[model samples]
Target: MNAIVIGAGVVGLAVARALAMAGHDTFILDGEPAFGTWTSARNSEVIHAGIYYPQGSLKARLCVVGKEMLYAYCATRDVPHSNCKKLIFAADASQSPKLDGILASALGAGVTDLVRLSANEVRKIEPALRCEEALLSPSTGIIDSHAFMMALLADAEAHGAQLVCNTKVTRVVRKNGQWAIYVDGSAEVAATADIVINSGGLAAQNIAANTEGLDPATVPPLYLARGVYFSYSSVLPFHHLIYPIPEQGGLGTHLTLDLAGRSRFGPDVEWISEIDYRVDPSRHAKFVAGARQIWADIDPTKLRPAFAGIRPKLSGPGEPAADFAVLGPADHGSPGLVCLFGIESPGLTASLAIADLVLHKVATD
Candidate 1:
């Protein structure tokens, strides 16, 4: 079978690889000049331990399973990654109850290695961290997202998958039990395939809307949540990732370090109307305040505005968080087609698992 996977983000690349491995002639399409340029490139790149998400949700299930698969793949593929672990802590006594709730949720999601740490235990592990209590997630880690995506593309190409860049799919239609994809770029191009998978990330809903024969009501509303990262100039004293209790619509402004031990704080949720990558310098004060909650000695002068990324969210302001939507023929009655929506946060960690699920959905049909 011939298959087409739209959107060349990490998830789309992984899906294309899975399809090619399943004996399908797969074509990976992206509008960007290079792969992983959008949502895939702009993320925390943290491997979640299936925490924070509700049990039985796609985010919880996939993140837990995918983290193991990702670590294994990185090791065998020589992708640079670190199992640096993470500490989700309660900065104050009042937040301790919420930390308990988080621990319960993580345990229910089958994350068995979480260790609850007392104040002294937390200090022993991270001397610079100030927290009443913390939960240590041994499975949570970080990866070089660029290298990871490159490895996935290499493997997909090795399995006979073709990646087309600088091309946008203007329209999709179903005819004669196959999919017709219309592309517009330097030249007008048309391609037919046996299956179509829309993993468009930020543009998923638009792709679904343009897909003929699909129900419009089945497509959920898309909201863009802009998150900005502020790089810290000085070396951080802590080694592991430090997170405060999650706030509404985000995991709070936490600290994450790159492979070179440079720490950065960010991702305060800001609802945006359109796609914008510019980072606002005014948010530096807020970041400083947020960072001071966890680390008492954070230098305000060292905080500099870094790049930002927009999350394709399903829920808007004041709404509850949404689960990852992997709509298939079963949901839309469209044979050999799958639409992915609201794949943010753990989407990176769950890329491989999401690919497997997409392949299974198409194969069983």
Candidate 2:
């Protein structure tokens, strides 16, 4: 049987690897000249410890499972990653009570390793931290995202899956118990198998809209949420990743480190109509204020503008966040087709588990 995985981001690449390992001939399609250049390449490359996701959601489940798989793969592939741990602090003295709730929620979600710490304890772990209270998550860490993606691509290629960069999936058509994916304008790759996994990420809605005979009304809206990051150019005050109490809407700007141990802060969320990578230096003052809650000694002069990434958020602000939508033959009534939407934040950490999910969805159907 033959299959095609759309979108060459972390999730797509992971899916391709899983399908290839399952003895299926697969092709990876991406419009960009390079893979993982979109959301996969941007943001803090933190391996979440399943702290923020709600109970019983895919994010919570996959993050915990994927983190284990990711660490295992990194070890086998010699990929660089660190379990440096993280501290989610309540900078506001008034937010101390909320921190208690955060810990309870995290624990309820199966992150039992998260424990509370006093301000003095926090400063001991992070000598320069200025929080009144915190939650130490030993499972939270950072990874070399590029290395991880390369490893996935290599594994997929080794398993006989092909990656065709600069190749766009223009449409989907069904014929004779098979699905044919149109590329550019002239060529088409037919999946003789009865499964099509759309790991299209941001472009998933458009791909679903183009799916043969899918109800246009059933296609949910895709919201664009832009996040920006900045790097600390000088001496780092802390050894571990530092985060603020995350709101239900977004993970607040937090200090995170790369594999080289350099510190950077980011990912303040902004909703936009289009995909924009602009990092507004004007927001430095706001970041300085927020960041100071964790590191009182953060040198404003040492901060430099960094890259930005936009999430394909399925829900908007003031509304409840949407769960990871992995649509399959059961939901769409179209055999051999699966669509994934609203895959953000924990998407990287959950890449491997999400692959398993899509793999099972295809196999069980």
Candidate 3:
């Protein structure tokens, strides 16, 4: 089968690899010149353990599976990553039960290594920090997202898959048991054997709407939320990723480190209407206020607007967190077409798992 995966982000690249491994002639198409220049580039780079998600949710299932696969793949490909662990800190003493809930969620997701710590014990791990209670996650870690994407590309290419850059999939049409893909405003199209997985990320909603024969009802409404990240100019005191127990909508302001050991804080979730990457410098005050609850000594000068990422959040803020919605024949009524929506947060950690799920859908459909 000839499989065409639109979008070359982490999820798309991972899906390409999985499809090629499944004996399909796989090709990844991206409007961008390079892979992961969007959400995959601008993220916390933290590989979250399957915590904070409700039980039986897709985020819970895939992240738990994908985190394990990601670790193994990193080791195999010599990708730079760290199981440096995570600390879901109880910044507010009254919020201690939230931390307990996080532990329970992780356990329900099939992780059991979580250990509770008292305030002094939390200080034992990082004496410079202040916290009333915490849960230690040995499985949580960070990855060089670029290196990880490169590894996926390498594997996909080695297995006879190809990437088509600057090839924007303008429209898709299903005719006579095959998908005809039009790229870059050109009428010239490519025919696929059976499957056409639209892992278009931010542009997914738009892509499905423009497809010549695709039903609009099959594609869910896209909720674009811009998450802004900030960087600390100083040395990081904490060795592990410090996260607050997430609220219902998103993770609160937290500190994460890069492979270079610089501290970056991010993804303070802000709802937006469209794909906007503008980092509001004015939000620094709010970021500082939220971050100080975790790091009391946050220097205003060190906190600078670094980068921003727009999540394809299907759900809005202040609502119940939603599940990963990957529409296949079962949902879309299209036998060989797959559409993925609301693949946010653990999307990176769940990249491989999503890839496998997509491949299975392609195969079984």
User: Per-residue lDDT of 5-31 in model 2, one digit per residue for the tens?
Assistant: 999999999999999999999989898
TM-score pick, better of 1 and 3: 1
Model 3, position 344: C-alpha lDDT score: 81
RMSD of each: 1.3, 1.6, 1.4
Candidate 3 Cα misplacement greater than 4 A, ranges: none
Model 1, CA-based lDDT:
0.92
lDDT by residue (1-365, candidate 3, tens digit) is 88889999999999999988888898899999899898899888888888877778889899999999999999999999999998888876788988767777778877778999999998888887787888889999999999999999999999999998988888898778888888888877755557888988999888888776677776777777888888999997889998887765667888899888999887777788767888889998988987787788888888999998988877776666678998888777887888988888899999999998988887778
Error of 3 at 30 (Å): 0.7
In candidate 1 the C-alpha lDDT for residue 261 amounts to 89
TM-score of model number 3: 0.96
lDDT of 1 by residue, 1-365 (tens): 99999999999999999999889999999999999999899988898899988889999999999999999999999999999999999988999999879889998987889999999999998999978899999998999999999999999999999999988988898888899998873233389999999999999999999899999989999999998999999998999999989987678899998888888998877999999999989988999999998788888999999889899999999999999999999999999999999999899999999999999899888
In model 3, the Cα lDDT at residue 14 comes to: 96
* CA displacement after TM-score superposition, residue 41 of candidate 3 (Å): 0.7
